[model samples]
Target: MRKVLKADSLFFYFFISLLWMEVIFRVSVMKQSYSFGILISCIFVLSLAFLFFFLCSFFKRKAGFFLSIFLLGLSSFIYASQFIYFKFFRTYYSLYSVSNGGQIVEFWRDIAAFAGKHSILLFLFFAPVLFLIVFGKKMLVFKSCSTVNKLSLACCALFAHGTGIAAVYAGGKAPNSAYDLYFKNSYPQLSVERLGLLTTMRLDLQRLITGWSPDIELAAPRDSKYIPTPAPSDKAKEDPNERETSGKIVEYNTMDIDFTQLAANEKNHQLKEMHQYFEQVQPTAKNEYTGKYKGYNLILITAEGFSPYAIHKGVTPTLYKLVNSGFQFTNFYNPIWGVSTSDGEYVACTGLIPKNGVWSFKQSGKNYLPFVMGNQLQKLDYKTMAFHDHSYTYYGRNISHPNMGYIYKALGNGLDVKKTWPESDLEMMEKTIPEFIHNLPFHTYYMTVSGHMQYSFTGNYIAHKNKNLVQDLPYSEQAKAYIATQVELDRALKYLLDQLEEAGVADKTLIALSPDHYPYGLDMKTINELAGHTVEKNFELFKSTFILYTKGMKPTTVTKPISSLDIIPTISNLLGLEYDSRLLMGQDAFSNASPLVIFLNKSFITDKGKYNAVTNTFITNNGKTAADEYIKRMSAIVEGKFHYSAKILETDYYRKIFSGNQ
Candidate 1:
């Protein structure tokens, strides 16, 4: 025992422990593809362990042993906690998210249940610490090292770190590559997969401290050699209002702001570049459906965990009717973002992608969002109100929503919905409808909560409330519970429609509702069970229904791909709001502008096909080959959207551009 357990063995123990935790995290949680990133991660992780090893070596024998144990325990706990969070939300929480995660306690019951279920994996993560606590003293030396020895250890640490840095740079600067993720991008998942969680979080802290922002450069369109086979148009049917035009010219949904003038007169280089970029962007032409709902009241809702699976004629009749009745989008995707719900709302409401690492909506409270429905309609003398059935200040919506020109309300504020584990959306509608139903031409927004996760009958309050209704459904318990929660949403919509009809504004009120994200709370197995087929994880997992309906409208089907990002511009166009189309990242769904649906991981679906960023493959819609140039151009456009969106949050670009106008 004495011969094998040498003082030099301390480094081995530390290295093994750190590597063990990192490998467990990647395999159990991330399940990332085997790539050069794994090699880079190992180098970085080795460097980290060496630094810890040296620090632990400086303490006295007993003190160093205890310190080693504590460090290992703490590391294990951190990894385990991250795993639990990812399991619950299907997205890793950033340092910013953790700092603002006071509301995490609200899901304690669900979290506890998750821990119980994944306890085996948790034990695997903590196995290193347990091993250390049991045999660390016997297997390793913890005595303080000599001065010369300590100096040698310190040098080793530095050399290892330097080597790691060299390995990272050697990986090259391609998009989503190890080098790009480490230096330029803020993609949390990919960063963790490529650089390891420790390095990713370290860099996150560094960026947070230094106010580092990704550099954005203007992209020139790449010329394509391959020609596309033009298929039948996927545009929605011509509006009845346009059939009456009798050859009269159609107007486009655009404002008078000249981007050329804006760029020429701009002082800041960043804003000037933005203006020049927008100047070259072709604005969407006004279609027959443009301004079809002019002067109509708008009610936009971002339903919690809503999906196509939530829509069943028998289980959720109202949802079924609303989905199948008007403006049916066959390829609408509600892509999951970094900060799931808040990010989803930000994309749909603001027509901009959410910047990773920080809450973009909260940051936008101080910025000018002239294109959001709340601000756009409020300026036109429409009464605007926003509601949430959760904490008023959760995700800082209290600050963000009101800034969007809404009389925002939630549990802590004016709204009076009974507090529950997951509050009732129906009760929210019941309590708040009277406040604004009488206010004609109102633009109301809702962030519902009844459809929140922990899809178990015992854990979810909303699920229990409607348990009897879903009892007969032939599905897994989780799936049934998920549907039960959505049943509450169905009832809420029904109540809303009834009230609108009673107020004699059912036809005049245009209700546009979409999910904040897909039903991520449920496991993929359960989702597949409910879907009755194996849903493709990459692009199809995000496929959801967008509800755009009034009392009676022609049922128009749009086959072109769209996304939650397009909601703002689509609504803006339909309401005849004066806005610069080029300024928004999303095009109007009904516009002649080519349909482009962007996902969080830089994946995109265009009228031509879907491009999976992770696999670097494009699947054409009509089996015709897409030009490599087309793919490159689209990738550049996606990258630009992400880069400039982040810049908008950091620099308040919207306010800068519209300063004189505002």
Candidate 2:
């Protein structure tokens, strides 16, 4: 035992300390659910630590020790960073973000805020690196091994790693695909719980460097897009020539898709498969609410960090009016996708899940994003325009907005709003109104930034600008600061309403507003303070406001599970515009189609229940749960949506399906 201890005692001890600290941080601080699966993942992390140490063993003793300490420091930083980032942003970064180092620099204030609150945990994360550097070479003993023996041991480490991975595969119930392995099943928090920080970083680096990606095979929809035929057994199905059924008349809107014709004409096997798939998707039924706002102008806003908590009538009357009077969605969500606001905006704008890691909006710059609200309205000669108060090129919106059929503008572009550190939403509305307000039958999209992060009065200009309004609120400083920033948004909406009223389009213009995400800038404690209770982190944290109002349209309340991903198709349906429902990932909330909300981690919420994919557990709202086969079937469908959404971004599938769209 002594001999073996000396063999790799320093690395072994260091690794054990790092692993346990990470485990405690995750289980205790991050408040991740404790499970035996995470224990299995810790073992896998230990194997990785051993393999890394073995790989470095080939170097001279002192050199290897120093290098190992360096590796330790790097791993410490990554883990600590992940913890801090989650604390501040409630999202994890990919290795691709390492390439965007400047973006991280921009969040130094956020990092400082996290460190101020959680110093002890952060300190412990780096203690191993410090201890190893101080004593690893001089005080720690290492057993001597010949170069040949080191080589043999390294090979053994490789064999052990392979075996551990195979063990995870055979016993761990991990998702089958390599992509699903790291992404779908093991999200960052869960991945670290299961695969350790070192291993997670290793796979991330491997993925980023090798230009390798998960080859997700998109499942085709089972039924063709054509009208479903009655079963032969159901009254000896009359001639297949009868395409319409009297019992139910499904409305396809005006999306003139001849699936039969497209299938016959398409030469590409991939395109034909896509056509076949969409043909089977259930088209959203046109209810009495359909075309309720036909030919109405649109003012769509994706507000930064806005939430239901920010919608106080006293502080934000315009927002309050919109929420109470418009098409109110009682259970709308704005899930934080992996890429933050860009992806959040992507879901609302494109009605699709953003592909993980890559900026899906940027990739869609070349694709036919006809389902985009602007694009759909543009076909009718509505002057479509998009505005962002921040950098226009942020997230490649410069390319993407135009692809969505909008004449896009941002801070540096044609639209000029006073530039503050975070910019001002009120100024954005004031400046942008003139451009499109007079253009009757216009559809405008605005990505507001006044409600952006580092929610404090001192550092945040917008928050400070309205600090006096929130100072009296009985809330934490952080919570007050958040509301202060949103005060700017409130004023902006007020300004927008006045301008529309003056422009004679208040009632004729449909205003739809939603937060890009929850206020991740506010800590969970602050969120609870605001909510006056403990908000369930998994699902309730995502609860948000989706405002749709056209001056004084009849107030209709929609109580259904819906999300930002449902925005595009819903708007298209309300405006009676042409859209292929089968091609969209989300259904219109007002339509009879079942509501399904998907999270970045693949967890989901349906009307019946919630499924946290990380735990592989489902909890039905009622005691009567869905059948295993039903859940299994829904899971497959959800997986297919994710897979195909990614495929659409990568292969530009829409351009192929709708050749005339672009």
Candidate 3:
């Protein structure tokens, strides 16, 4: 028994340590209900650790000892770092973020605070290393393994890996299943939960290097359109064909581009397939709201970490007025994307789902984005400009915004705002409004920065600046700090409205605003305090307010479910812009088309029901029944949206179709 222990001690330590880290990570960072995939992840982790063991066995006594220690330390650091990162950001750190992440240095203060708060868990991760250093020499044999032994270890590694793969296949190939994540798709958070972090990172690096993209296939067509039946007490109607009852022929928000002809002329199979797919998509019908704000000056703002909880009448009265007044969308959402702010901005401006693992906005810098409001309105002789309150080059907005047809400015280039940890949104509005407000028939985009993370008075500049105002709030310090930062945003909006009114364009201008994401920096407990109840994680966590306000506009409320993804198309239709609604992943909210709000994990909410992908269950609205067939069809549609959205980024599908005309 002693001899056997000496011979295999190193391997056992590696395997046990790796398994321990995986379990710890699963419990803490990946705090989701797992399935058989959890077992598969364990086996896969075992196989990887075994491979490390086998490779380490090739070294001599001294080298082997230090190598094992190095491997163990690396494993500990990866798990520990991911734990703190997820806790801090409410998302996993992707390899892409790491590669492009010089700005991460700015978050060192927050990271240090996180480390201090979670020191126990952080110490537990490194305990294995301490054990190896203390007792490794007495128990672990560092002698080089014989060729025969090496061969056996290698065989065991391969066999275990093969078994894990087999188990994954046995789990099934349904959408978001273990098999789909492993072989076809890449949803980073879900992938980490199911496949283990190391395997997910390996796949991410492989895809990144090899230019691999998710394989997209067309879903089977539905037998009939899903017309949701609203319950008796339901105020909102859900008829799929319900629209304005004017005695006029229905015209769709479509362009003159012949997709069928484009597909026939295209040689690339993927581009052809995309053209064919979009050609068959049903275009949204024009309604009474269409052209309601035609030829209006536009100011689109992607507010930082804004939510309905920030809509207090006393604190953020401007926000309250705008939200409650013009084009009130009671059931709106601002779904958190993988890349958070950049992805949210991409979705709102481009009407596309962000491609996972990479900065889609940066990627789109190189692609043709004819659909974004900036580009769409630019062609009509509108003076288009965009501003950000932070660094111009942050998230590569310098590249992406210009490609969107905006004369872009941020901290480094032009638009000088006071340099703080997070620059002031109010200052940005004050300075940039003058740049474009006087330019008649203009469209400007503002990416606000006041409501950024590290939500505390000490670390957050904006929060500290407005701390006195939130001092009397009956909530935790973090919650108050978050609200205080949003107060800055409220003031910024007030300034914008005043300026517009002064310029005699407030009535002629349309101001549309939505958040980049929810205040993920605040914990659920703090969020609950602000919300006055437990916020439902699946759907309600994302329920936010979308403000489409113009001076003297009617306070009409629409109860259809919508998301930031629908912002571009909704505004495009309302402003009477010529855009093919079929090409966008989201439909015009004012149109008769059924509302579908897709979350990051492929969970979706439609007028019919809310489908939670994690639980594989659907909850119908107002106790209305949804047939299994209906759920399956909606799931397929969601899957297609994800798949094709990625494909558009990969192939630059829009540029392929309209490159000649432009």
Candidate 4:
């Protein structure tokens, strides 16, 4: 009996150790919250209790011990494979292109740093639990299982694992279809076969991963001015037989309009009035620095999950500097992109509206992306590079980054760091800035991860030690915790600015700071607590900050409403890049676009005031009522713009517009 108990203890110890190994593997890959560990532990404990009770009722001790060992080993192996697949190979099969070496290195460094910070606690929590399982009497009863029962249990475990593996493989290979299948099976109430049919037609993940290799045909380059014959004006009044014969006999060709033509069209009366309004509100461009440094380098940082709460008067001085001294956009709005966090990056960088229910960056991998600051500046002989301190391939950014014309780098791909979960923003700045700064005429984009959500002490680094600082903020505990995470983001920004100054390129470098999106997953109560009251459920609540700081530029403010899509044309004009103004859907708010034609669902704002398309109501802040005629005209204009933007993306119209191949 004593010997049997000792053997059982050993088996339990092995089982718990295997479980800890699985947990560590998952944490390294997913960066899941510590709460996941607690949940896993609960599930594991229950499984063990079930096993022990079943074995003790009928089996002998020795047999149970062998059976438990086999189950433990098998489960551990299966869990480990999930981590490996998710961490390394998952992105290769995604629609987005995979990142190269430098990018992966940058991501890995953050993961290492995160692991170092939590390793001690993880070990302490897991070690004793492992020991108790191995030596505890409950484990000894499992050793008594009969051979037949043990084999049956092992087969059941193997079958369950195979099913899980198959499901994961199928889901990864055909995400949309698998998603539809899951919804149909698990949520019949929400599942629609028609919706699935629509989605499945366009969602070809396999084709996206492999890319198109269609046969190429070279043709004479065409210009936008080459217009096709217009349809007869009297077609509506013509006989049906005449129309049918005409349609059958000859195909009608539509004229393709180029960006230049589109811009020219927008130069009409209404747009001219809108452009005038923008010029009146445009801030003065300041060149406070007299000397011309080699050439200006631009650094655009889109911090993930960042919010205005990160900005404090004293706590974050550099941010305060940018907000106060640079060309600060007080009413700049970043509308939530369809995919939320990363999709917002796509919109801001590419100045393209994301497609409904699909990731624009991923889908647009095959489309021509013009006006990307990185791609645009590259034409000026600038060495353009992009950095992300997380997995380089998330959201298919590895592919999209190259398409944006950046030589990309992430934690695991190239840049080395000390931690995981989130690589230190400061470390990314420290390692990558030197490579580009010395080479003058360089533009670098950084996507930061330190401020990501899951605002709890164990899940986030900010809440680990800095809770005391925000404890007195007039917000809920969760809100305060969210704010605390930004401390690291704040510190990283200050460090990057200091490095630029130290490198003597501060004046020549333009730093554009923008949040990827509003931090939305926070509870409404928490958001309301932070806002000091309930926030309006409309578009304004989703608005974010945009700051463009060029060292030694005179501080000015623009209060006119603007979205991130405007950044491209705005910055291009500011930098004096000769991009055709018409090609971009977003006009330089400093150019011909209205102060308000911002599109969300439908166009919400017109020059006259805010218009709710659904309710067909217009409200002016100045208390001036708009005439019925003006509302009708404005709605028509908004609808026209939406139709044009969609056509531009769907038909690949920009290539002809900008390339003079209309």
Q: Which candidate has the top score in TM-score?
A: 3
Candidate 4 wrong stretches, greater than 4 Å: 1-295, 465-469, 597-599, 658-662
Q: Cα deviation of 435 in candidate 2 (Å)? A: 1.4
Model 1 collision count? 0
Query: What tens-digit string does per-residue lDDT give for candidate 1 at 248-280?
Result: 654545566667678889898888887776555
Query: TM-score for each prediction?
Result: 0.93, 0.90, 0.95, 0.58
Clashes (backbone N, CA, C under 3 Å), per candidate, total 0, 4, 0, 46
Which number leads on lDDT?
3
Q: Give residue 353's error in model 2 in angstroms.
A: 0.8
Q: Look at candidate 4 and tell me the lDDT of residue 585.
A: 49
Alpha-carbon local distance difference test for all models: 0.84, 0.76, 0.85, 0.55
Sorted by TM-score (best first), the order is 3, 1, 2, 4
lDDT of 3 by residue, 283-322 (tens): 7888888999999999999999999888889889999999
lDDT of 2 by residue, 570-602 (tens): 888888876767778888888766678888767
Candidate 3's TM-score:
0.95
Using lDDT as the measure, what is the rank order of every candidate, best first? 3, 1, 2, 4
